[model samples]
Target: MPAFTDIMSDAFDYFRAYALRALCKARAMPRGRIKHLQLVVGRIYNLLKKEAAYAPNTQQLQDFRAAQQLEAALDRRRDDGSAPERGFAAARPGAEREAR
Candidate 1:
């Protein structure tokens, strides 16, 4: 059987990927959906933090910090109405004018 730390490390990696996908999805999501994703990211950040406390390794600490940053960025985007603009910025240069 794997060690407890190994199990935790695997779980951490899984949640980290999950959080990344959620963050990307949040960028294009509506405000209400972004709000829900923010809560989910917050939960994942808390989980990473707790794991860091138990493991105290460099990689774990870095992941915890990244999760913290991701949550903060999501909060900022949600509050500042930037999420909607992400889609606009990704459009072709003349797409906005053409749509108008």
Candidate 2:
């Protein structure tokens, strides 16, 4: 299987989009929503990766490996779909996930 980073990032994108839609509705946006979003995405990715890697080998692990492999293969496509804002410039704490 491929590195965990690709797999986690793709999964995060799917869930993050859904979450953004649900929480984005408001005349005045909640404070730090974007930052909070980033943290949630990171946490989900780490949790999934940990569950897949640390647990004993099993059918679930096999499934995880396959999904991660597919994610790596489609990384370019996935990244293009999830490109960050053009004008957003800042090294936010915990914004970037650690490479596995």
Candidate 3:
């Protein structure tokens, strides 16, 4: 069997490739859709943050950091006007009601 570190490295590499592909696809999507994708990534990052807090393992921490970076990138994209005009609130449910 492969060593643990080797397996982890391979998995991380695969994850990077998959994320890149998804990002490329997202670039072609409409601004509203990108906002939704950003929201989804943000949620994933938050979940990873919680998980890392509970487990406190190296791998978990690394994954949490990666998610955090991705979330930041998405936020930057949104802020730069590449995502939406109405801002993040537009992507959340009941945002219109909340805004009123």
What C-alpha lDDT values do all the predictions have?
0.64, 0.45, 0.58
Ranking by TM-score, best first?
1, 3, 2
Q: After superposition on all CA atoms, what RMSD does each candidate show versus the true structure? A: 8.0, 17.4, 11.6
Q: Mind giving the per-residue lDDT tens digits that candidate 1 earns over 1-100?
A: 9887665655466565756666666666666756676767756765664675456566765765676687778778767976564433526777777766
Off by over 4 Å in 2: 1-31, 55-100
**How does candidate 2 score on lDDT?**
0.45
Candidate 3: list runs displaced more than 4 Å: 1-31, 49-54, 83-100
For residue 10, model 1's alpha carbon misses the true position, in angstroms, by 22
Sliding window of 10 residues with minimal summed lDDT for model 3: 7-16
The alpha-carbon lDDT assigned to residue 39 of candidate 2 equals: 42
Better of 1 and 2 by lDDT: 1
Model 1 TM-score is: 0.41
The candidate that wins on TM-score is: 1
- Clash count for candidate 1 is 0
Which residue pairs in model 3 clash with each other? none
lDDT of 2 by residue, 1-100 (tens): 8886655544444434433442342212333433354444444444554554444335544554554454344344334756444544447666555421
Every model's TM-score? 0.41, 0.26, 0.39
